[model samples]
Target: MTEPAADSRTELSSLLHDLHLISSEKPLPPPPLPPITELLARLKEKLIGASSDSETSSLIGHVERLFQTADPDWLFSLTSVNEEGRQEELQAAYRSLVCALIGCADLPLCGDECSSLTPAAYQSVPIRAVPVCSALRALLGALGNWEETGLLWSVAPPVCVFAVTHFQDQVWTNPPSRAAARSLQEALLRAGGWRDSTHLLVGDGRQREEGEEGGKSRGILGGVLDVLQPQLTKDSWQRCEAVKLVFAWTLLQLARPSLSPHLPRLLPPPLLFNDHYRPENCMLGARCLHHIILNTPAADLRQFNRAEVVYEALFKHLYSTETTVIQLVLSCLLDLLLVLEKPPSSLDPSSGRRKPCRHDDLLRLVLIHMEAENKVALRRVYASVLPLLVDRMGVAVCRHLRRVERVVLGYLEVKDPPEETNRLKVLEVLQRMTRAAWPRMQRRRLHMLLRRLLQLMDDVSSDSQLDDLIRDKLMSQTTLCIKLLHDCSPGNAQTLLLQVDSSCCSPEVLGCLETVTMSTER
Candidate 1:
């Protein structure tokens, strides 16, 4: 490299001084930058020999200003480098700038700081939040142009990994800082940085073993998990929410098979959240667990009794009174249950001696809860999950016929307003149960269920609050449930309908029953 004249050095120092004094209230517009190329070259030269923190901070401020005020294309241009050494120079410059920017942003850039769980490790010093946030915004602005220039490819991995691990509560919770961090993340992924980033964050087996030897060698994702796992405990998860949210956002972007190998590390945090006492955290945990269960291969989940652990965590949430929490837990458990045991195929032989497994236990619990459930939202959730559970249980639903019949009858007797969501779902459950346990659906069960369907039709017709659409929906679903019951028992519903006097029943109820019997015969 040629020695720079004193004027070049003076100009660079003047630029840095000016940038240091710029007001933070508004963005500085791009200045005339024909000298920026020479200034950047001079800046790089100074950065190589820069030793003091003060010198580095000053240089980082100048870089942040250039990022914000300069055209990205002109700012990142490498036209001056010879072709033979272009790649090396480009990489060195990119690294120096990124490291400086990350440092100025007060984020963890090196392995040791990244891996540390202590709060002090994340906070380097008492730096101004605005300046740090501004540095991050500048970095994000530069990164946002990566797709157009493609010069950022080499440094994308570290920058992305740094953002994911360090952009937590402080950066993300602030409105402006959050926008910058989010934009940086989108740019990274959009520029095809996720591949390299994933490799760096989620290393292969050898890299993982190396990571285990010294925490310093761990990939950013693993290192983050180390810090995150301990904080995900019952009493501590609230404090860790910011990091957990970022972690999940990253984890969800990764698909199956790729995510499978890391399940053991990835599984615990969500389980802890799911097991938390707070509804919001518990819902978040269930959603995370649900994502993991869906993406992971069933064999991996079953390995080391992982599925059972997840099941136990989620099963307890079934008892939660928060309807939203219970809704998420039910969704998570349904998928998790499949990992523990496969649902029976239609061709599989029925065995009366088969042991009652998790499915049976879950169904029994849901039915027990359903029978006593009065809150409309809880009733809606339980009713919605029941059909899927019944379908999964297949012929084994015969085992819970008494409770199932009671639940069906009880739900039918009540009115779920507006759309009658609970009643509609309960009718679907009846249809699935009828199909699954047809042999058990004999005359007595058929009669009890049939009577409820007729009365539901009557009640729905009488309720002036229900609009034409909702009333029609209830009548149609109840009619279907009756038809399924008739098919299972064959002729019992017809006999019961015949015995009903027209004087006691409304024309609408009697008309709906006539439609079912007619449909069954045809």
Candidate 2:
């Protein structure tokens, strides 16, 4: 290829310099060129061999002018090079374009550019072939890398986690390499946290840890946790936004890896075991924690080997002499179990489903631990865990009730009928479990449990004179009971109908109950 003339090269250099200056300082206005149709015509002429070399230079200069000015209107001109055979040069140009774009804050190019690039355009850009495109692709790949890297190397554990929350599918499908993942993790770590007044991915990496002024190498998890705890309280939404990145990081980490055994060292111990009566805290923490246990097929849980550690760690909280800790552990445990039960494929025999594969053992251990607590404690745990357990094990959890004994049931039986709310809750759980177990159930226990739940439903409806909240609760329970009864097969319903009468509840409640009972009897 013949070298370009010095004059042309000098002009190109000067134009690039000027563009950079404009991009750096005051915004450069759009290229002082012809209208879009004219610009397209010029570009078309160049592509179809109609325009001369000078005309091609002019077209490039016009694009440079747009880059200098940071004009969104100039964005349309980018389509000029969006033709076939020019991709190699265009992709190279786009990198410099993006880098320059990142420097121009006034145009807000990142957000706008992200929107303008369609999925087709994203596919067209061979990110692997070009530097600028590669960088952008690297950023995209980092989202997936963050979590798996955490599991594999114990690096960028925080950012790796949060990235999973926002881009789990991306991470699961195509994970980046360990090195690329680490770099991306650091970029996110530096970008996601706060510094005085900014929420950024890259900035002055100086930040306070839990409001204290010091730079400790506490790892990504600690740094993020430190930055987040401050923002969680009242009247600090900006801080909250910054902290959200940390939560996002946590969720992302969860998507790929089990919680590191060392994560507790990063966060306050109390957060792991929140106060149970304070449903707000328990709910928030439990829900935040639920993502960790969610069905993520790509996640590698065997890397951390935390089940035994978690079981040992949480056992104290579960059997704690203190009521609050016990409550929090129960709430957290229920969430953990729910995640375990879903997407049956995760439990496939050959899928590297971790060491503690016998989930039944875990449940048995938990039951044994909670036995020493009072019925109130047992009731609290049962209520939170019941929904999930019923959904998964169905009536299986309640089977062989006599062979497996817990001390809490002793107090459970002694409670007066007036305090039957706990019993009602247990029955609701059993009823749902039985329904889920459906055809899998043995006829005898199913019949007995259905009869017991039917009587409990009657007890609830008859107590209409109770407090308004309790009365509303009982009525709702009655509705659920009727729905379950109607769903049961005629033979099963008929078997129970002979033993439990619907007349135990008020006439109004019994009226609807009679229709269900008679329909099932038929």
Who wins the TM-score comparison?
Answer: 1
Worst lDDT 10-window in candidate 2: 101-110
Question: How many pairs collide in each candidate, listed in order?
Answer: 0, 13
- Candidate 1: which pairs clash? none
Winning model by lDDT: 1
The segments of candidate 2 whose C-alpha lies over 4 angstroms from its true place after superposition are: 1-308, 334-358, 365-378, 394-424, 440-443, 475-479, 482-489, 495-505, 518-522
lDDT of 2 by residue, 1-522 (tens): 223344443443454444342233332332233333333333334323424534434444444443333222322233554566543343333333333322221111123211222244333122211222223233333323223112111222333433332232321112333233344444544433323111222123334446452213133444445434554443331222223334544434432323433344322322442333333444444444434444332123223543334444444455445555556566556545443444221444676552333245545655554454455655555445544543454344444243222322332343334545555465465456546544544556446545554554555556655566665565566456545644655566655655555445567556555667665556
lDDT of each: 0.67, 0.40
Q: Lowest-scoring 10 consecutive residues by lDDT in candidate 1?
A: 210-219
TM-score of 1: 0.70
- Residue-level lDDT tens digits of model 1 in 1-522: 232344443443457555443233433332234434345455656655567767766766776666665554445554555478764666566656555555444434223311324555445432423344455456555765453333454455446644564445553234445455556656555444344445545544235342233222233555445545664555555553355675676577656667886787788778766766667778878888888989889889898998888888888878779999999888888888777876743333555454667888999999999998888888899999998998898888888989998998888778787788888888888988888788888777788888787778878888888989988888888888877877776667678878878888788888888887787778
Model 1 spans with C-alpha error above 4 angstroms: 2-8, 11-130, 133-175, 186-240, 344-353, 519-522
